[model samples]
Target chain A: MRAEALLLFFSFSIGIVTGDWNILSYTTKKRDHHQHHAGISLKNYCESWRINVELNNIRGFDVVPGECVGYIGKYMTSTQYKVDVQRAAEQTTLFLTNNFRLGADGKDAWIFDIDDTLLSTVPYFKKHQHGAVLGCRGATTNSTSMEQWMEERSAPAVEHMLDLYHEIRARGLKIFLISSRREHLRDATIDNLVKVGYLGWTDLILRCAEDCYHAVANYKTEKRRKLIEQGYHLWGIMGDQWCSLVGHPSANRTFKLPNPMKKAL
Target chain B: MRAEALLLFFSFSIGIVTGDWNILSYTTKKRDHHQHHAGISLKNYCESWRINVELNNIRGFDVVPGECVGYIGKYMTSTQYKVDVQRAAEQTTLFLTNNFRLGADGKDAWIFDIDDTLLSTVPYFKKHQHGAVLGCRGATTNSTSMEQWMEERSAPAVEHMLDLYHEIRARGLKIFLISSRREHLRDATIDNLVKVGYLGWTDLILRCAEDCYHAVANYKTEKRRKLIEQGYHLWGIMGDQWCSLVGHPSANRTFKLPNPMKKAL
Candidate 1:
């Protein structure tokens, strides 16, 4: 591996991910991207993604990934995934319309994060319950299956997000889809989004090889910050991770979709 | 101090001032911001800022205020301060007019660093030969004096940067003056800049108390990124130090005025 990549990856060996020298804190290992819920079982864990599978129709398990959190209780299949996202989207749309002023040009846009926010990765996760750590951070794992799954271009769309996608486009705002997926996945990713009926997007951005070692938040913020610099008003940003929501050039507002499937702290 | 502030200060003590996290490898301690030339005697090393008193039409003995470096050669009269900066400004003007396209609305801007770039603190550094290693990094040493100097706002212009500032503005682009100076000094900084004949800036940003501990590069870059997000195209950024030029949302090109005044390795 390249020296920079080595530094980026192994730097985590230092306990203080907050170590200023290692670059931004890649410090939080298992916690970097997703959260591990209490009772997450293999099927229940979403890894680093947000999944919305209706467990026995109690809505969805609203469960955690990897370890077993528990049997679905009255915990509101009312799942955080199901409840909050829809509300955030509705409120954001209303707020933007009531307050923002866009130029007559139809170029105003909203950004969407691909994996959990737009497409559901549940189907793939079901087929391979191996995305999580085997036991400790020392598991010997192979990603052949996951690569095949990504290459298959077959993830389905989240119903509500699809509705919001169309709603924002109909209002004459452009959509910019940015994903942390490697640049090589560009074709498959585009195919999947199109096959699932996503349209009118101004751009679909996949991470370049150089970005493989970057923190997810740094990578996303840099891109969004660039887009903002280039004269686009990022009306809103929709993502399943907090990393997506917290940085500068903040969207006029943001909507977070629950991706309990992924691990986040 | 706030916990975050302490973290910021302590982090700097790490040799990683060149810490990749900051993107700007703060290689030099006393050298981080400016460089003092060879043969700079204790009396000669007027460290904190650049003082061009013109001792030998070749400029006087330019010395250090912080740590020790080497001696001066034909360096003074050969002061890069006098030659390179002027040439850089002329060349930059040529580059911008030939390559960039400005929006009719006049939102394009060039960011300028206040100290050493727009105004020289040579006046203040002359009195405080005590600006460097006072003992503990805990409390600031000469800030009362530094703050007083700031309040006085008598630092003179770097001359060439000022010319470039007006040139860019005349081309229909706005000017942005951003400094790593503390937030409390905002009024004095502005008053000083104006007192010294610097004007027409769209915004004058000073470091907030909260950001005093941030690495100089990170602080400046974040602000530039925000400006881009707000739809302003940063056409150029000129500062005496590399820290100012190396981050994201790069200006079309940057011009570095020679300020070999502070002590560097």
Candidate 2:
């Protein structure tokens, strides 16, 4: 009896040790899988959706590659709606390039807003359930850490517009990218621009903490003023939001218009 | 008498051939000397001015380190001026870091204009002025032959700014480069930026043929709008021309002002 009891005790101890070791190994595998998934999933999604994918040999506008964060979420649910959005992007590039006589003499410029204009961050908001995904929350003002939430987020770029950008470049005009992303996201933003084939500006402007504005419209107006002062004549302006195009005198011209949707804003 | 005449003619013919050979060698030497002088004269003058000499490092915002171009003529008026520019650049970096709250976490962004803003193009322009200078005025408007002219042109950057750019980057806030240059200059521009310490942008906007505006202000405004759309609250913006600051609501903000001398319209 004594011998049997001793044997049983040893067996139990060995079982416990093995169990623990298995758990540890499982946890490590799980963590690594999560990391790989984050990177691959985002890239895969972008590729599949053809968002930011280059068409033909033309490269999009990007100052830096692989640094900017992109958040993908449903902007509209219906397939018909997506088609509409894509069409709007196509029309916008077309109207701006053709009607405005852009690219003549290489002095024309097109300005674009980043957030909803290029990609949507609504998915991040949905996933994290964080109100105002990119914005500061309550007492936690100016938190750059929020950008980390963008790691697994990305959406497809509007189709057919990359070719339009190429067409514009072929004509000798310029595309200017403007973003309100904090200085921290500069690298990521640039990466996305290049990836998307919108890379064609002589410069890029990002919002810093000091650029506090009463409203988004005011911020856009101020930006327009600066470009005019530099001797670039505005030919086209594009944005998902009205505030991006509002308040600038040039916006009144035919070249400036909201993303064409059947229901105008 | 006939034999004497034939001998004299033969001697005369040989002398003519030898004389032609000497003339050919002399012309080749003269051309080489002119080329050598063009390259060395710039170096010597820059050295005399106490300017930091770097030839290959002239990729981005840095000054090209030679006197072959009119840059040394236009800006390097004297050693005192060179020293003053260097000192001013150092002061600018200091001011940006300490007073402007620059850095990744800071609220200001220094937007640098590539051509004429940070780098001098006078040399490139002058070198391309050859045929035109020789009263071949029609060559200026002829596009087919412009490539030949461009082949001879060499634009050098401002070296001090290149150093300052790197220094500022080390300090942390983003450096947004805005230029009116064409897309073909991208590689050269990026090379220049890297050589001078501008690694890459969080965002880089370039002017392309597709944009609608001909004014820099229009391009700037678009950039500002995008920044706002990205949700970065900007603190400060900087550029060589006033138009670069346009559309930025913070233009009048105390921190947004460029150097007093640079603020001229």
Candidate 3:
């Protein structure tokens, strides 16, 4: 393995010093097609964009790039998406198996974000051009549309999250479902979560009318702060959005599910 | 655009429900050529692994997956890698251009992680099988070997980071480079930074001998805590490793550079 790796490294470095590397030929040939702006194929471009979004490098974009709409649509519905989310879930399970030492004091807790983490609203996003036309948190004008969709309570459990949720619960951790959904949507949220096999979570916290003005990160951060103040040791926070997982007084660990449909703040 | 996206979404959903979609044909064909595990192409698997690493989903990994060495070798040397980093740098530049109100006080500062964020240590890793063998932080018995390489001071500036560094400097924000390299290597580290077109910074902080026992995250977080205590308002922190960016008292914003070479804890 070392020999093979060293050979490739030398070839690459030599190619860099001299501009005659055939390894670059593949990308160059694809660039000539000109279907995309950069010579990168749609697959490579969208994948890189998704990585950037996941890394929290790309932020505050209201909509998905128009050029990547189809790519994102296909990716969200692809086997690769299922594999990615499952892998993240697997990592969480592995961490629990290997690292976490649960306290018997009953103060141990785990936080799970609702949208695109517990329940997937991809069906809604599918109609909205996969976050090209409208996203869940971007425009207040779309709030009515988003709430109506939530009220339908038909959103499916994200691919592997239900299993992971059950695993966390089985381990005797208190589960908190903190969401950016408004307080008025409480009934619909519970109904959807229950219908999708998420039962008996400790609390389902949502945004009150007063909490609506705060950014999702700040609201969630405040909720976590209150939880920590209540003497709960947050073992982990799981979410599809960076805003859900980042801020002061962060949990001991965080599990980020894959989401190309939307970036929530 | 919406029509195109809708067509793809419908096709994918229909395929998911009925189990017949031509879009899967491309991936299926690629999967047949399995020189790797999971029936997934080396490119796809390595890319996903790299994304998981960047997202902090994959943790405590000591080396690159053996099967992925070739794929990672090619990717690190590929135009795609350069484009990915350049795109991140563009986002930072765009952020500074639009938002970010700088204070007249020099206390408004930006923090940069030294290793892959500013200097490309790829040359050293290139000889180390691109981290299939010795990673910077994972194996400290490698200190002598790593220090000797650092002392050579021949490492190049990571593409685009030098420009971003200069941009932040021109904006008059005090810059701090907080690195995980031990204090013994400070002279070598400074030499490499200077030799690679990096000049002038508010401070170059390194881990002291007593600090070597602390994990990289804790050590850097402590450094950041001191900076914050000293009244330096951290405007942003940029790094390739999550350890350099995440934790309490984090900067107001963060920029994550793409680094598949190594994941430092």
Candidate 4:
């Protein structure tokens, strides 16, 4: 860190944010403990920054560009989430490696939920009520806020799922991004995925206008049924919410990514 | 709140444990985020205190008495763990309330792991390396140490699990305490349970000498099978480790309590 940035960081956290916020920068001097193998990640860095920002109601991170605004949505995931995600992913990979036979027809597929699964809305949620649902009537003064935020095209690929997506594709399996998002927002959603490094998905399926009134689980289960009827085998399904994974014709295996930010919609 | 205690805390964290250990005490001024609602629990209190204790490598908590040595073990569950555990329990309670038929046979049973499920080992593990397995060898020097601690019978009932246990038993069902601890410690273990307000357990099953050589899962699985064969309906099994919950004749449902402290031996 440059001297100026260091001084400003101290100023932002101690003087601007809260004097107690500097405690996060605290570490042990006992150099000999078992080192945490994964060093601090950009996601973790943003999470800490987001916590302080919310606590202080600060507009943005100090000394960083506005582009980093979207990064704060990677909030809520702390060190424990990182461990649990890795464990679940590894188990999925192992289960597939051991049990899922490659299809001779190349029709085997995996389903992934978009928000909080493949991408995050944490940055936007941090600016609003962190756990409030962004439904049509859920927000105040700006119902279009959700649409505007979506247009920012900045929901970053969730770290573990992004890696899992690549590995599934590498294994010559089909991957699909099925979301609860409205179909009209498809273009921006696609652009955001592309910008955020999500690619090679066999397809991106969004909810049609008629499906807006259904429960999220009902809409998602219907989508899963359609995929199966179309002759695609959902060898595995992964989502941060149960709405995406449960109900009839469930995948051969299902992985739930943790999202405790709110009551499930 | 004395200046002397504050100075001692900083010394223990920075000068004794880690030059950077103060990070664990970091909190925000907003004072009101989503208030974590199970309220201030003994384990929760110990966990926050333990984070600072380990980071600073300080043995005693400042402004708190010294004999709370065992309290150091409430170790490293993060904010996420609290959220996840509450969600799962709520889901379980909801599911049971909605679905399970009331059996007049009174033969239905619930299985609970003793440590970290019914009772917390957080206070013990907080002082030791969180992940260091408490193997027989690890216990000998600590063996007398373990015996001493058990005699203190200080292991408090885990807040959430105790609630669930009471609820299950209140419904005219059965609750069993199954643990990986040795048969020799049964007396103290029972004392701890009674003192901590745990009662009406159908049985407290501890590992005998013959079970010592088996993997924990194998031992637990075998015990579960015996219960099944003996005609008890294992409606639900709750545990902190997979070893206790997984493998054969699975319960109608399983509940996993989070314990990131160590890989179970």
Candidate 5:
């Protein structure tokens, strides 16, 4: 209540203050622990930044901010990250069970983005400074290293997603695994999926030669468009990237899993 | 490091474990205080839910989850929320000062949402159980109460947005305040804006009889469409709701301020 009062006080004060307006100073004032409230600490601020990133308000970033490396590291490895993923899975499954009605034609399908959505790439990210090096796009040493990492065929399945995969199959929904990973990695990717217990899926779609130059959103949209043309009803599309779920010809519902470590546009 | 290893261990273990899969159990395992991780507490889960909300992943929530009332309360009144707003404003200012070029024509305009974006209706929300009642759309006793609250003309300016408004004005770009508030409240709304130091803006567009039944997004989109028809170049649109920024004929950029109190879609 006191904090609310202080905020209101500050709000009116800023309105009345005559000089050069510095709005941040009023809200960010550091109160002592002995006083009513502590100010916004670096950890608190980074959490806010992460919220912004997840909100898709902050985009087209190559890497996490320099100061937020430790925060991001802790967040990725923390129980919070696990809980977030579980909640996303829960929501998707809840929507599927309660609202979605599969047609008799067997044309009902669900799109799953492979990396971060269906597979755990956090181990590789942990080794690479939690998105500092390997989270970016395009041809560089980072991309080459990422390719080698994919080639190892050792990435684990995203925890709840494997179960969700089985649930989708059991419900007779055709599972289409769409990934931004290039076509050349398809063999290794399949091996990785099989090893990780994603034994059967309708199709594993990867970026081919025709998709090389397009943005991730455009490429994914094209894939969905093709599915639409093929007489498939996309029931749900799940991914860690907004690009996976956005664009025209969207699914009946889209679920976004949390991945603060990387953003692809 | 231990957490990361434990997560990896769980990731692989889930794949190998054969029976009926309850995957959430694997990741959400609660450890002792003496052990490596404490697992996800209730507080942690609510935080994740909040993240999901901000991500636009969770939508159409009627009220803050009953268990999350306290968490949302602390978050709203905390320094963290203020810092989030500040960071949003900072990002907007950075984009404006660095990337945005004002045209010689007066048509280069910016759009601002009224409630939550320009003013703080938190006081009324606090009285109404932090959006338990008033956040819903349509005519009800809650709407009447909310109308009375607005008529008081006592709402405070959202801390950083007023400054952003001034900065936008100083840059010679036309400013349009487009709100979902009915036209009946225009006088009080204008009074509130003036009382809180938002002295000048190009126009204040409010909903009228024709817009009574339209979804907020559609209404705001129509306004933008009309602006475009009038040769307005919407360089930027800033709002607390996604509805304000989305839809056809979008601006060059859209900035979303953090607001967890209410969702109108």
Candidate 6:
């Protein structure tokens, strides 16, 4: 009976060890998906619901050569609106610069996402109540002034946050802005980032025309890998979507701030 | 006074936010280093403190084309002796298989460090008195029974963890065993992994004589990039040292188990 008890005790110990392993593994797997998505993408994904950009015909918008304007509409145009696109952009910048280690080590870099992250072009479609507003005949072609639109459609950067960005550049970190805005929106997006006090960056990376075929995360990862290969240790990354941080381990220590206009995306 | 109160509140909030970001970034950075070194080179680095292998002279040893053995002395060797190496190997395996989503869906793969991770050759070293006996003039020159020299040198799979691997493989996940072990030791290491139930991996990446210049983490990252180019998403990675997981984001999620033999390099 003693011998049997010893054997039983050993077996029970093994069972406990193995059981712990399985539980830990399951918990970890669940956490991987959770952490990868976090809450950052939830708001963005919901906002995407209002965006009816044809996944296949993203190019038809004449994004290049044609001037584009961003508008924040005060309407519930889609079932997926979670945050107002304008407020989301302000909160993203404030949260990232204030919370992350930006402009450190004299290596200036900034990673940004296009779409609702940087511009609120979603308004053009909502005003027309459709996804293909730009492609529609007779759509207004003249782009609105970014400064005026920012004041009218979005909240300006909080005073302290703008000051913080100035402080970042004063430290000598060369800033690089990365985005998935597509090559066509490059000129307008750069103009917007500059008008909004993001003029310190050294370079801006926009998504190539071919990037439409890849997942947003994959595109961001490849861009980040290229940046690292070019010998830059990015100090900060900001995006309204989790996809922006996919390949950036250096900037994984991120910050998420509340988007006050949580219903108008 | 009202202005002062508001200023104070904002300052306090900014302080808290900045402090939290710093702590998170530091913790993740440290974890990155830990995950980078959790493999064969970690063991080799530890071993280097005792035996220096001249990379240039490794070819000289290859000229003999026979069995080579290294023996480590008693448990109490020097101040560098650590009792945690053995425990770390077991724990690392458990942590890796549990936390990372490692299944085929072509979404992830693992690069394992061989030596201490999959096999404990320290027992053989101890039996041979830290390679002193084996290093003696005119040691056996042909293939010797690795299992026979030291009974403890046998590579034993962490039993409960096999299910995790089987699960990974069943889901189509690829596994690669990377080692800094000499090219001559390849067959022995492979045989050990097979005997210990770690057979049927996607690839076994080893350090060639010409590939010694780069740090282990750099080497692993380059290899991982190639795998990624091949369309594999690296969701999980494991190593016993800081250099093995350097370039991958998953390295931040590495687990460090207790090392039973804390040999230092």
TM-score of each: 0.37, 0.32, 0.81, 0.54, 0.81, 0.32
All models, DockQ values? 0.02, 0.01, 0.19, 0.10, 0.18, 0.02
TM-score of chain A of 4: 0.68
Candidate 5: regions farther than 4 A off: A1-40, A132-140, B1-40, B132-141
Question: How are the candidates ranked when ordered by lDDT, highest leading?
Answer: 3, 5, 4, 1, 2, 6
Tens digits of per-residue lDDT, candidate 1, B165-215, equal 776777888888877677788888888788866788898887767767766
Question: With candidate 6 superimposed using the best TM-score fit, by how many Å does residue A128's alpha carbon deviate from the native?
Answer: 27
Q: Model 2: residues >4 Å from true position, as ranges? A: A1-75, A102-105, A129-131, A134-146, A150-156, A252-265, B1-265
Name the DockQ score for candidate 5: 0.18
True-vs-predicted CA distance for residue B18, candidate 2, Å = 99
- Please tell me which model should have the higher DockQ, number 3 or number 5: 3
Residues A1-265, candidate 2: write the lDDT tens digits. 4323433543343334321110011111112432312222232222212111110000112211121122122213222223333334444554555566643456577776665456555344445432333321111232344466443335334433455455556666676776656566777777766665556567777666666443445656787888878777776676544445545555423222112110111
* Regions of candidate 3 where Cα sits further than 4 Å from its true position: A1-45, A132-139, B1-45, B132-139
lDDT of 4 by residue, B128-207 (tens): 53433443112334446555666678987664565667778878778888787888899999999988778999999888
- Report chain B TM per candidate: 0.66, 0.51, 0.82, 0.67, 0.82, 0.49
Candidate 1 C-alpha error for residue B116, in Å? 48
Runs with alpha carbons beyond 4 Å of true place in candidate 1: A1-65, A69-80, A130-143, B1-265
Q: How would you encode candidate 3's per-residue C-alpha lDDT over A155-205 as one tens digit per residue? A: 998866887898899898999999888888899999999997899799999
lDDT of 2 at A262: 8
Model 4 chain A worst lDDT window (10 residues): A53-62
- Give the CAPRI class of candidate 3: incorrect
> For residues B45-124, what per-residue lDDT tens digits would candidate 2 score against the true structure?
23222111110001111222333233333333322222333434533554554555543545445556664445644344
Predicted model with the maximum DockQ: 3
| lDDT tens digits by residue: candidate 6, A1-265 | 4324433443343334321110011111112332312222222222222121210101123332111111113222211122122123333444455655643455546554433444444444344322322221112243233223433434233222344345546656565666544566666566666675656667787666777556556666777777777777666665433335434444633322111111110
Please give the range of 10 consecutive residues that has the lowest summed lDDT in model 1 chain B. B51-60
RMSD of each candidate relative to the true structure: 22.7, 29.6, 11.4, 13.8, 14.2, 22.7
Chain A (candidate 6) TM-score to true chain A:
0.45
Q: What does the lDDT read for residue B35 in candidate 4?
A: 36
lDDT of 1 by residue, A81-198 (tens): 2323444554456666676676686658888988767887656655554243111111123335555777999988764567678878877788899876778778888899999888
**Candidate 3 residue pairs in clash (backbone atoms < 3 Å):** none
